[model samples]
Target: MSSPSAAESFPAHTSAASQIFTTVLSQGPLTRSEVARRAGLSAAAVTKAVRPLIEAGYLVEDVDEDARPALGRPANLVRVDGGRALFIGVKVTGDKIIGVLTDLCCRILVARYVPLAARDPKAVLGSAAELVRELLIEADGLGVRVAGLGMAVSGDVDRAEGVVRYSPFLEWRDVPLAELAAMTTGLPVTVDNDVRALTVAEQWFGAGVGLSGFALVTVGAGIGCGLVVHGKVVAGAHGVAGEIGHVAVDPAGPRCHCGNRGCVEAIASDDAIVRQVRAATGVQVADAVEAAGLAHDGVAGAREVYARAGDAIGRGIATVANLLGPERVVISGEGLAAYDLFADHIRDAFATAAFGSAARCDVQTRPLPFDEWARGAAATAIQSFIRSDANQHLRGAALTQPA
Candidate 1:
C-alpha cells in the first residue's frame, strides 16, 4: 500500500501543533480564540501551529458571519478535515476479530468480523494481517492510504512495547505483536489493553467526554476497569493499571485465573458465574448464556449465583469509586446480556458499599458492540500518530530490540 500523502501528515510534529489539532478535533469548528482558550495556548501559538495544518489540508477554516465582531471581522472556525487520512483498527477476542476502517476523525466507515480458528499468537496475527489487508483494500477504494493500525487485546499488554505481555484468553506471553504486524501490514502499529483503548475512545468521543475523571467497568468474560484520572488514561509504571478484576473481594472465594482467590473476576466473570451456577444448581450449565437463561427462568440456585456475582461486581466498582472518586462509572461488556438478573444487586451493593460522596458518582450502563472495541483500537492509533514524541519514546531500543 502507498504511504499517506504529505497533506495527510497534518504537520503534527510539535507538541503545540498536536495539541492545537487535538483541541480542534475534539471541540472543533471553533475560532482561534476558542482553540487557544481550550488548549491553554496563546493566540500566537495557535496561529503558528494551525498554519501548517491548514495549509496541509488537514484543517479547514470556515468564516462565521453571525459571530462577527462590531469591527466587521468574521470569526473563522477551525476543524479537522476528516478525509485527510485513513486508519484500521482491530479488536481481537477469544471468538472473533472485529475490524474497522476509520477516517482521521476516528469515524467508522466500514466494519467486519472474522472468526478465530485458533488462539495462538501466530494464528491471531495472520488473521489480523488478513483483516488489515482487506481494510487497506477498502481504503484504496476510498482513494486514501491507511496511515496506521491499532490492535486491542484483553490482558496485560505493554502498549509502549507493542507486546502482549500476558493474555490469558489467547494463552500468549511476551508476543511482539506490533513489530510483527507492522512488518506484515507495512503500517505503524499500536497495541494496547483492550479496555484502556476503549476508555480512550470513550474519553475523547463517548461517555467520558469532557469529564475530568471517570471509570469504565466491563463485566463479561472478565471484570475489566479502565480509569481516567485528571483527563488522562492511567497506565501504571509497569504498563498495568485499573485491574479491578484481580482485586480480591473475598479471601475465601473461588480462585481466579490470575492465581488470586475471591477476586471480583473470580466471582463475577462469565466463567466464574457459570462455574458457580453449575455448582450451586447441580446442573451442567455450559456457559454464561445458559446460566443466564436458567436464572431468568427463576431457578433458585442460578438466580442466587447471579446475585452473588452482582454483589462482587458492585463491591469492585465501589472500591474504584472510593479510590478514584471519579465523576461517573460506565458499566459495559457482553455480560450485560444477563443484566436483568443482577441489576438490582449491583445497584444495591454499590449503594451499600460506596463511601460518602463517592456514592453520588453516576453509574450507568451502555452496551457497546464489538465494533466499538475496534473503533477504540483506531483511537489508539490516532493517539500515537498525533503524539509523535510519545511514539518515538515508545519505539526506543529496549522496545524495538528482540529478547
Candidate 2:
C-alpha cells in the first residue's frame, strides 16, 4: 500500500497565530474587531496573524454589507475554511472502534464502525489502522489529504506523551498509542481520554459553547466527568483531573472496581446497576439493557435499584456542582438509554444535595451516540492542528521513526 505525502504545512506556528485561528474556528463569521476583542489581542496583531492564514486558505474573509460601518468601510467577517483539509478520528471502546472522517471544522463527513477482535494494545492498533486506511480512501475520493488523526480511549491517557497510561476497558497499560498509530496510518495522530475528547467537541460546537465553566457527566459502563474550567479542559498534572466516578458517596455501599466502597461508579455504572438489579430481583440479568428492560416492565425491586443508582449519580453530580460551581452540567453517555428510569431520582437528589448558589446551575441531558464520540475525537485533531504545542512533538518524532 502506498502512503500519501504530508499536506502543506501551516503557514504560522506562533502562539498569536494559533490563538487568532482558534478564536475564528470556534466563534467564526465574526468581524476583525470581534476577533481581536475575544482573543485579547490588538487589532494590529489580529491583522498580522490573520494574513498568513488567509494566504494559506485556512481562513476566508467575506464582506458583510449589513454590518458595514455607516460612515467609512465595510466590516468583513472572518471564518475558518472547513474544506481546506480533512481529518480522521477514532473512538476505541471495549468491544469496537468507532471512526469518523471530518472536515477542518470537525463536521463528520463519513463514519464507520468495526468490532474489536481483542483487547490487547496491538490488536486495537491494528483495527484502528485498518479503519484509518478506509477513511483515507474516502478522503482520496474527495481529492483531499487527511491531515491528522485523533484517537480517544477511556481511562488514564497521557495526551502529552501520546501514551495510554492505563485503560480498564482495553486492559492496556503504558501503550505508546499515538506514535504507533501514526506509523501505521502514516498520518499525524493525537490521543486523548474519551470523555475529555467529547468535552472538546462540546466546548467547540455543542451545549458548552461560549461557557467558561461547565461539566459533562457521562453515565453508562462507568460514571465519568469532563470539566471545562476558565475556558480550558483541565487535564491535571498527572492526566487524571476529572475522575468523578471514584467519588466515594457511601462508606457502606458496594465495593468499587477501584477498591473503594460506595463509590459513585460502584452504585450507578451499567455493570453496577446490572449487578444490583440481579441481586435485588433474584433473576439472572445479563446486562444493563436487560436490567432496564425489567425495570421498564415494572418488575418488583427493579425500579428501586434504578432509583438508588439515580440517587448515587445525582449525588455525584451535586458534588461536582458544589466544588466547581459550573454554570451548567450536561449529562450524557451510552447509559442515557435508561435516563427516564432515573431522571427524576437524579434531579431530586441533586436538588437536595447542592448548596445554595450551586443549586442554580442548569442540569440537562444530551444523548451522544458513539459516532458523536468519534466526532469528538475529530475535534481533538482539529485542536491539535491549530495549537502549536498540542501533540507537535509526537508528530515530529513519528516522522523520523520508521513505519
Candidate 3:
C-alpha cells in the first residue's frame, strides 16, 4: 500500500469534477450536455471536469452513433474507465469474512470467503486480513494495484473516526477498525456500517439509482437501515442515521440486545426469530433456518412468530416512509431466504401503518448474497476515492503486511 503522499492524486479533484464523474459513473455514456443536465451544472463545467478525467484515463469517450442528428455531428458519450484502478472490500460477520476485489466501477472481479474460528476482534481481524490478502493476490494476478480497502461492519460505526463505536452482533465497541485493517492489509482503508456501505452501492448501481431519496432496510442477525435524502447518503450527526432497528414498536415485546424492549430488531432479526420460534413451538430450533423450516411445514405457532417478525419489520419501514418520504424502500438481507413466509405480513402491516401519501412509497425486495455485501464495501472505497468530502480519517496506509 502506498501512503497518501505517494498515491496518485485524482485529477482536478474538485467537488464539481467529483459530481460530474459520479454522474457518468452511475448514469454513464452520456453526452456532455446530458451530464450537465443530470448534475445540474453548466455545460462549461461539465466539459472542464470531463477533460482532466479523460486525460487521467479515468474516463473515456465514444461516438454515440445511435443519437446522430440529421445535420449536426454525432454526439460523443463519456463513461468511466472501469479498469483504471482496483479496490478490496471486506464484510465481517459473526461466523465469516467475505471479501471481493473490484475495479474503479465497483464491479467484482474476484471474491473470497474465510470462516471465523472466533468472534473476538483479534480473530475477526485476522480472518479479515487473510481474506484481503487473497483478494490482493488476485488483483496482483490481474496486473492492477489495489488502491484501497473498505471494511464494512455491523454496528454504530463512526466512519469519520474509523471506529466501531458499538457492534452488538460482534460484541465490539470503540474498535479502531480502519487503522488496524490498513496495518494488516497494507492498504488505505475506509470503514463503515455494513448496511450503510450496502446503501452506497444501491444508490450508485442498484435499486436506488436515479432516485433522489430512498431507504435500504436489511433483515438478518440484526435489523438495519440506510437512508438517502436529497441525492446524498445521510450519515447522521453522530454517525448513526437510519437506525430503524432500534425504533420501538411494541412496549411488551422481547428485549433487544441494545437494551430495548420491542425494538424492531428484537422481533425481526434472525436470532430474534429463532428465539421467538423456539418459544412459540416449544422446539429448540438451532438457527433461523430451522425455525423457518418449522414455519414452512405449517406449524401454526412457528408461523405466528414469523408473522410477528414481519409485522415489526413492516412497521419499521412505515416509520421510515412517513418520516423521510423516500421515493422507494428496498427490503433485503439473508433473511429474504424466508421471504415467502412473511412477505404478506410485511406488506399488510406497512399498508396499514403508512399514513396518507407516504403509502405511495414503492416497497420492493431484492436478494443479496454475502459477496454482494462485500461489493458494497468496495463501493465505499470508490466513494472515498472520488469525493473529497468522504471520511478522511479513514483513509490511511500501512507500511507493512499483517503479522
Per-residue lDDT tens digits of candidate 3, residues 34-97?
9999999999999888998899899999976887888877778888999988988999988888
Q: Write the per-residue lDDT of candidate 2 for residues 174-279, one digit (tens) a residue.
A: 9999888877866778999999999999988899887889999999988899999998998889889788899998999999988989999999999999999999
294-384: candidate 1 lDDT, tens digit per residue: 9988887999998889899999999999999999999999999999899999999999999999999999999999999999999998888
Q: Rank the candidates by TM-score, best first.
A: 2, 3, 1
Order of the predicted models by lDDT, top scorer first: 2, 3, 1
Query: Lowest summed-lDDT stretch of 10 residues in model 2?
Result: 394-403
Q: Which number leads on lDDT?
A: 2
Residue 142 of model 3: what lDDT? 74
Global lDDT of model 3: 0.88
**Distance from true location, Cα of 168 in model 1, Å:** 0.1
- Greater lDDT among 1 and 3 belongs to 3
Model 3 worst lDDT run, 10 consecutive residues: 394-403
- C-alpha lDDT of all candidate models, in order: 0.87, 0.89, 0.88
